[model samples]
Target: MTHLPRRDIIALGLMTFALFIGAGNIIFPPIIAQQAGEQIWLAAAGFLITAVGLPVITIMALSRMQGSIENISRPLGHVTSLLFTVVCYLSVGPLFATPRTATISYEIGFSSYFGTSSSHLFIYSALYFFVVAWVSLYPNKLLDSVGHILAPLKIVLLAILGLSAVIVPRELFAPAIGHYIDHPVSEGFISGYLTMDTLGALVFGIVIVQAIQSRGVSDPKLITKYAVIASLISGVGLTLLYVSLFKLGMLSHDIAPNAVNGAVILHAYVQHVFGNLGGLLLSSLIFLACMVTAIGLTCSCAEYFSQLTKISYKLLVIVLIIFSFLISNLGLTKLITVSVPVLSTIYPPSIVIIILSFFWTFWNKPQHVVIPVTIVAFIFGVIDGFKVAGFSKLLPDFIQHLPLSEQNLAWLIPSFSALIICIIIDRYND
Candidate 1:
């Protein structure tokens, strides 16, 4: 009988936290706080729901199935499962989130210390992805590399910064701004979409399963228990950090009232509180955070592509690194702008899948209810996708009038309503 020690559980939890806290996770909360002002708690509620709750639920759900995403979609049949898997991989991989990690480390970390020029970005990304490609070639080592070494370093730096923001006062916070005045929680929820951790969690579940197995924890129940522990650790850590960052933003809005984005807000806050050393701390934190996420995404992408194409993992790693490096040089803002439409299209359906995966057996009709609901969600998802791309402005007035449409959750009702309809039809037949 193999016994997994308490240290192993803690290490897994640490790595889980590290993997989840990427560039977007680090950047968004403060800006939301800044906008929400005195309404910080209300806004934080919404942010944590998607940012913390969604990812935790996702990991726990996947863990129960032994962390195989395909198991969740098996009821959808093979072809659809493959397509869903590909979209998930691409969204978290080179097409959007992966590239943004490098760019963010440069923008928020390096650009703060150095200057933000294209040549500097070019050199930085090449060096960054080279390291990612190197570490990712061996997936078995991530628990040690990320869990023991990198994760702690990231945790410590963020802890120091987060605490300082709490202890010091930059200025009195202003009133809730704009939409935060009327819809703090909903706006915060919508803002959490920018983090995209839920989407990443679906892919990272595989990484967690592989790492746990590498440690000889093979029983599905034990693995799921440990994964649940890891997820709780991640959820608690993320929620605390977000609360701290939101406080900082609330207090420092005067310093960056018209700043371009959250990066600028973070830079100003860190520098004001800690001085030159603060900037160095921030740089190190971003580097470590981005590096871990890059490694995780790189491995996940390489592994999935290798399985899909029958190519070697080594070859896929090299290809993904090269592609991500090229795409990352597009810079953070450009990459985000390009990603909005794609994220809009995929994220709603991804959420639906996570929810359905959990409730699949709840009604005993996974095949009948889940697939139809997902298709309807995706259809409405495409509509929201176009709205994100700015092409859906001409959409009929009725579309804008749907419940929760203002917060970009227009698909929630229709998708769930479809499931209910399916359930009713099945019940009558039974």
Candidate 2:
């Protein structure tokens, strides 16, 4: 396989970055900085841990693992691979993430314009999803077009937002005293993971790989080399943007004393800098940017699942878009709140698996070691998700009556114990 020219590699990297830096990212960092105050840098560092680091690692893992999502989990057998892929895609796409794109687009984009009418919002969102569904059905040209429009709009709006904060004199607010006192760095780090942009990076890595293949770089070694370079560039760009946004958020506290949420903070910034017209333009841009992301995610999920199940891609895209549209009515805040526990539960196992794959050559019996350990970790992770989401009450009385009932870290003990046992067992087997 001929190596891609350096310019082509950079272009691919930029495309990869464009794919990962979607709507949630534009809103998340500033919120973190606003809440973190003096601890903004600490929070930024933490966010990078998961947001940037994990994503780069994921790309490396994918290149190392080769093939599709199924290939990465082959050590765990076909059923487990299929199940894991389904859960990951659903979590990242329609089940939780896709609807969020629409809801957020509405909240940040149209909410100020449309006001608080549930019926109207539903009708508008239904129409938006119809467009998304249509675009997904004709993905190739549609994605390129929407992406072209949205990517630049995102950068321009954000540049204006960032510049406003940079020019304004910062009057730092007193940091809120809280239980987040002892280990701000660690708290910030974990908080960063919540962005889940890194997870998106991992899922989108396959898309990047395919893009490279389409360019005729089919050699595994060449693919891996270019993928790493591309992911590095993308990760750096995302981390810088996150940091800038967080700082902007911190500064905006002084500018918009009434700004409650990240969306409000952003709106206030635009209004302050550019007045009503600017604010309206910003909102419109956000709507288009978010719509583009939603379309990409929905199409990606539908296409992948359709391939896996041998279903018609058009039918699958329509079904998923309809489902996503129905759920999008839940509203932006609700979607973010609902997704957290699920992400917390699933993300750890996925991260661990990706990390482990880097050392595939080190494990003489990867199936014995990796498969059982991942399953055990996942079982605990699932329980932890339920506990966090307040679903433990639905468990059998006997199960809920177990020793760790009152403890939020109920999954920790069993997950670690299983991991340790698996490592020891694998050592002996080797």
Candidate 3:
């Protein structure tokens, strides 16, 4: 069995971390800390659970199943699992995430220098996806190209930002506001969940496994072990990054008291502290972070679709790149408006499937238990999506009163109920 040398393992871990640290992951923590204020740590604890914890758990789940979403979802049956896998891929691929990477990287990294006109965005995305396509077309070299090269560059930029957050002077902590005033943990959990890293993990799991295999490590046991190690390393890096961003946000209250979003807070803080150099630093950081993530996503999506449709991998890469470039031109605001609801719908079910996969062996009929629970989770997930899309009034009054419904977690209790009921049936029927 070929083993990855120590240096290779670290690079692989760095690559995994880079894949998870896209635009949303970086922006979210600061805003979360701003709102949590004096209760920042309390809220951070919750944020880390979903943002850092859940994604790592997801990687672990995929590791045992050889990093295939199709394999992990096998208990859902063939057709259903295929549908679920397709949705996950599209959600994290061209439909939303992949495109958003371009828009955000442009907005945060280049818009100030190049302007935010449609043509400007189109040109940026054109060049952006061009690079993504170039790297993605050669999946066999990802370990060397992405793991060794791009990941390290991204980490260096991130470290500079993280260090600045600690060393810079800033305002006093603001008071907790809104839900964070009383329900800090839960509110933070929701914020972290909305980052969509868990879903990203589902898509990126295969990429991580392949990166390991690229190092000539073909042993199944060694692959799983390395995958879990990579996840742990990524998890630690994410936790540290989030904490630093949270600190930056907490101290930014004075400079950006009326900040509407994390981007506003980040912009103000960086310019205020770093002077003229801040813009360059932030832009470079965002670009590297988004670029690495985009490459990973593009590679993963093309790999999956090529296998599924029996199309040529090179052709799929070109198609996905062109599709993502067009979608990104819709601009970030509209992309976000459309994506949030769809993400809301998918997250609960994804969470359900990922968490419950580990316990399936205990059930006499794992399919009976897993399938119903997943279905119930998906049904409520759609309701949450509707609520997010501003169609709450269209829902019944009772939905508003469900446990944790206000937190967009109405699926939780129902999914648990279905799981227990199915387990009982499995026990008795068996």
Candidate 4:
């Protein structure tokens, strides 16, 4: 019969927002904006759909399913659900997103001061993960540590930078480049995959729920209600932040014309506008953004693995931290190179599971529809992954002719076709 007061819910929402706006969310928009140029708004719209919309929807789904990815994915059967859940945890955990948080904070925040030598990166990541470990080891304190304190600080820094981007005058936007010139919307949509928020949402589901439970709210209805409200707050925050970053990227061409990534564009813009003090502001912002996310990931990963293997949560945190540190040493550019294809392969299936879970009550035989659609999505998703990794020859020629193939969304049509067919079968059998 417990009910969380209004402020507790707001902090819970901010904690969720802080968890989602990690390295990828902060870094990707600027690069997308810079490249999409005059087509930036079109691209931004696409990015928002996946980055903001999908994650919000995901949290809503998780809310109903009692904040467990396993619950939502249970229709896939035990082994398949276990495999899928483990892969998702690893993908957004130590293997990719978590480590990227460290590498990015270093490169964007401190790399200028310390220089980008491999030794420097190693030193910084070591210190970074140490702090992540400290915070993550005590998940019970997350609402206070992250939600009330860290999230607010991160938001203030972001607000300062976002306002600067909007209010400052700069040169005209650069011309649209590459696929962005013609397929800006789809390109932006695909690029949103790079943010990995949807995957993060799956992993963070329990974390959000636990944060609410920590406040003594035990009613399932209240839990779901609070979780949905948190997601809405986070969604609105992400939308505003992304819009400003897109504008920031468009204005940065004159200052960082040859930038390779959003980090470079962000660094240059801050320096051009704020000078030495800007370095301080940028570093503070990056640290807060990356650190909160790293803590959330580390906490979530440790908690899951501990249950799966019955190991000590603290030990898992240490092991995962070390592993993530080693992988992060591969550095930012290389990590992105390695991750894009993997993400491409996995994202379609994950998206299918999340979106379809909403209609679980509608179908008597959810497995029939879920399994077939998932398989089709994963098959074409792997083909798209191969294409992204420059291994297109490994794929048959017909894949190239798939609708939306050029956008790396070649899986869409066939997946839906499979879903429709399965739905018909499910209904007829019923």
TM-score of 1: 0.96
Better candidate number, 1 or 2, judged by lDDT: 1
In candidate 4, what are the lDDT values of residues 139-180, reduced to their tens digit?
Answer: 888999999999999999999999999998774777899999
Taking the tens digit of each residue's C-alpha lDDT, what string does model 2 give over 1-430? 5777766676666666667766677777766677777777776786788788888888877876553567777788889888887888898888788888778777778777788688867988898888878776865544244434555566566666666667776657547334235545656666666677656755676666766675678798998888888789878878777777876787776676545567777777678768877767777667666666676677667768877889998999888988898888887668767887888688767766777776667767888777766776677667667776888777777656654444333444665677678778878886
lDDT minimum window of 10 residues, candidate 1: 358-367
Q: Please say which candidate is ahead in TM-score: 2 or 3.
A: 3
> Model 1 over residues 105-130: C-alpha lDDT tens digits?
98888875569989999999999998
Which portions of model 4 miss their true places by more than 4 Å?
169-171
Candidate 2, residue 162: lDDT: 65
The candidate that achieves the highest TM-score relative to the unseen native structure: 3
RMSD of 1: 1.6
Whole-model lDDT per candidate: 0.85, 0.72, 0.90, 0.90
Which of the predicted structures, 3 or 4, would earn the higher TM-score when compared with the native?
3
Q: Name the Cα RMSD for model 3.
A: 1.1
lDDT of 2: 0.72
Question: Alpha carbon lDDT of residue 310, candidate 3?
Answer: 96
**TM-score-better candidate, 2 vs 4:** 4
Look at candidate 1 and give me any clashing residue pairs: none
Superposing every Cα of model 2 onto the true structure, what RMSD results? 3.7
How many clashes show up per model?
0, 2, 0, 0
Residue 273 accuracy (lDDT) in model 3: 79
